[model samples]
Target: MKFDFHSHILPGIDDGAKDIEESVKLLDDMAADGVDLVVATPHFYCMNMRIDRYLRHRNAAYEKLRPYLKPEHPRIILGGEILFDHSLVGNDKLPYLTMQNTDFLLLEMPYAKLDDQIIRGVEAIVEDRQVKVIIAHIERYLAFTSYKSLCELMNLDVLGQINAESLAHFGTRRNCFKLIEDGYVHIMGTDMHRIERGYASLGKGMDIIRKKFGNDILEEFERNGKMVLKNYSYEQIVG
Candidate 1:
């Protein structure tokens, strides 16, 4: 149940894995890192990318890697790291974009500013559509807002997904620890793109977690992920 819930492992669709070789390499890294499942979340900016075209590209890339998919490797689940836009407020297709058939959507919020309208848009998606949202790379958005703003955002019914790299590389571990200790962090993702230029680091990130936060922390993250995937009573964990 150790699921890497956000990644760009699909080849040539987005700025993730360049080719099938890189895709397999990323999968190998996931398997070595003890990830039992991975959600291949290529980037999707609704303002620009059309849904039909995105799906077609995604399926094509997925088909290319189908034969190589094996039980021993971390099983791939389809999802998208969607960049938030105001238009998503009432979009019916939003639910269809969730992780596999689950209700969890990996949402990458805007890095520009955290405004009331954007916050309401997120709430609308959850309340109106009944789709659970996981705010992707929560640490990345912290730079645009204050600690109070972050706490307020977490207070919403959605789950906050922090990037593994943020746990070590982003110089945000101190803040990440605060969020974790306060039960604000509900899940973790690698957000891995490529092997070169230091984008692939699922193994390295987990190593840091084990040394810094111990096994219990890792287990809790796994449990939360499993709960979401299984359609369990996620409210218990979210609160």
Candidate 2:
């Protein structure tokens, strides 16, 4: 099954699609692209959403989309692309917002650069508690430009998720290749906001993956993603 680990498909919750119709259009495109499952990761910015309010909105959106969802269609799972903040780590209620209530949390690091706090927060979530930390759109982390920090993050058992569009974008090719070569990237997400761009970007990335790594690697990515979606520990799979 092709499972997209990150997306902003929920309407009006964050910076994703504006309404349900747009959300459905994106889902339809995903289905056409052979995406079997998508984790509906609405943004959870630090300064914005409260835990209770976020859940309330997420649940309501899930219900609203249910009748339109077909079992045969690509499945939409619940999750959030949580912006990394110290407050989220200590919050007991935060884990419920993860995909299927899984221990795996899709975290978005700051866009500018890596900092001590980001490292500490990742350590708290993954190393200290042994939770699965899937770093969302890791290609955007400018710190990756420094090989040392990228290596440090890789050593922490954090899985890197690359955005499809980034791979297609100029200047990011080298970084994307390096991540794939270093085995840092574990999954690819469309991160689609607009309908026209979503599936096409994913296709472009998949094409690159296929030409460079072959079908076997793509299958492995899909398998790993399914394991994540099922809440299985990465250690179990790695072992």
Candidate 3:
């Protein structure tokens, strides 16, 4: 199935859709784009709020948009774009923060220097929390460190997610392709914040990959997406 691995479609919970109307529009557009499902990953900061309060706010936002979710629209899967923090290590709530019914946590690294300490913190979360960590929008951190550091981080069994919009420009597109060729990218996300900002780049980005790398390359991405949302078969997910 075509899965949008990351999104901020939840209403009023974070800096995403303002309310139910905007959320519906985002879902409908994603449906038109041939996206079968989308993970509604509003940002979750462990250091900023209590886990109970965050989940409560997140669930309530989902409920607000529930009535507008039609069968034709992309199905929503609850998840979070969690900021990595030392406090999250060994926290009992980490599992609850994973993608719904899956072990993958969409982890967003801090914008600071990408050092061994940060990498080790990520490693601890994996070894201790027992959840697969999907590094969110891996392309955004290019200025923070070198690809070698990222490859090293990848070696610890964490998957890397890239924003589909990263392929918008020539320089960025080459970097994206390099990541793909090097086998560093694990999944793609729209990172859709609002209609004004636009999220349609997902289809364009996939088309670029298909044109440059062929159908097999696109299929490889779909394959990884299937692996993440494996609880449901492709036949079972599509309406």
Candidate 4:
């Protein structure tokens, strides 16, 4: 079964799917595309969301949409697309968003260059031995002239996540393929947002995977997704 580990399917929170109707529609589309499970990863920017409030709203939204969920639709799981913040690392308030009880945390980086502070922040989290960090959408960090810096980060035991859409881009596809080939990337996610832009792009991404990598590669990607659902450690799967 296919699983989309990242999506903004949670309703009325942040920019994704303004209401339940849109959220349900996104689910239907995912189900039709063979996604058996989807993580309702709403944005969890530290600047905006308080931990208790985020959980309360997430639960309420899940409850409101429960009755409408079809048996054939993808199973919804709660998570958040957490933006990186230094305060989040030992803070008891934010641990719930870390891949559902597993040590792995989905960490989003800033769109620009990777700074020393970001590196140290991630190092602090890893050094604590409490969380194994997964750098969400590693492709965005390709602006660096040499991939040595990226390689250095990967050696820290941080897993990389690649967005499906990058596989189809001319400029980015080569690097994505290179990362996949080198085994640096351990997970694939849609990172889907709106139905119009996100859903359509995901479809194209699936096609790109199918055409370029064949079914076996796609199957392996799906297997990693299942591994996440089962809370498997990255060391167990990647090593």
Q: Write the residue-wise lDDT of candidate 3 on 1-239 in tens digits.
A: 57789999999988999888899889888888888889999999887888889988999999889988889998899999999998888888888888989878899999977899899999999787467788898877876888888777766767778888888877778878887888778788898888778765678889888888898877877878887787433223221
Most TM-score-accurate candidate: 3
TM-score of each: 0.92, 0.91, 0.93, 0.89
Worst 10 residues of 1 by lDDT: 197-206
Per-residue lDDT for 1-239 in model 1, tens only? 56788899999999999999888888887887778888999999887788878888898999998887666789889989998898888887778778887888888888876778888888888787557888898877778887777777777788888878887755687777777778778788888898985544555666677787798877888788888888655576654
Residue 197: error of model 3 in Å? 0.7
Each candidate's clash count: 0, 0, 0, 0
For candidate 4, give the lDDT. Answer: 0.75
Q: How far is candidate 2 from the true structure (C-alpha RMSD, Å)?
A: 2.0
In model 2, pairs of residues that clash are none
Clashing pairs in 4: none
Off by over 4 Å in 3: 231-239
Reference-based lDDT, each prediction: 0.81, 0.77, 0.83, 0.75
Top candidate (lDDT): 3
lDDT of 4 by residue, 51-129 (tens): 8888788878888888888898888878777788878767765567666656567788766556667677777777776
The parts of candidate 4 lying over 4 Å away from their true place are 143-146, 201-204
The residue-level lDDT of candidate 3 at 57 comes to 92
Sort the predicted structures by TM-score, highest score first: 3, 1, 2, 4
Candidate 3 TM-score versus the reference: 0.93
